[model samples]
Target: MAKARILIVDDSPTEMYKLTAMLEKSGYEVLKAHDGAGGVALARQEKPDAVLMDIVMPGLNGFQATRQLSKDQETAGIPVIIVTTKDQETDKVWGTRQGARDYLTKPVDEDTLLKTLALVLRG
Candidate 1:
């Protein structure tokens, strides 16, 4: 089977490097975007299997990007997982409302991230 391609949208270079290294080590193909607008454009063009989105970014935030993807016919089926520093209960709820399949906070646990990713991909 082909490895899943995961698009990671975050403005932080350190976070991007960390996530890319982790996902690559697990044999998943990683696509990167520096901010939400670029992420949305990439997602639309590439149609990656899943998206890992960060909430706080310049231009289009993750929530808006997720909403756009979820509502658009071409991208609606693609699952988005919000990966952000926002850890409040309300933030979680808002992420779900924006159509994220799952939510993970910054300093994410590698195991939890992989597990949640596997689960979402399974569905």
Candidate 2:
């Protein structure tokens, strides 16, 4: 079987590179977008298996982008996992309300990320 493809949307280059390295090392295909708008476009066009989104972007935050992706018929089935520095309960609640399948905080733990990916993909 072909490996799963993941779209990562983050404004931080360091975070993007780190996540890309982790996903690539785990044998997943990684697609990148620097902002939510580009990420939304890529998600709609590419229809990747899943997306890892960052909440605090310049325009079209992760919540809005995830909402768009989830509500859109073409991309609704794609799961979005929020990866951001916002670790408050409200942030997570709002993220879920926006249609995020899962949420992870910044400086993401390798094991937690992998496990969450497995669980989300399995669903």
Instruction: Give the top-scoring candidate (lDDT).
Output: 2
Q: TM-score of every model?
A: 0.99, 0.99
Off by over 4 Å in 2: none
RMSD per model, one decimal: 0.5, 0.5
Lowest lDDT block of 10, candidate 1: 35-44
RMSD of 2: 0.5
How many pairs of residues collide in each model? 0, 0
lDDT of 1: 0.96
lDDT of 2 by residue, 22-50 (tens): 99999999999999999999999999999
What is each predicted model's overall lDDT from 0 to 1? 0.96, 0.96
- Candidate 1 RMSD to the correct structure: 0.5
Error of 2 at 38 (Å): 0.4
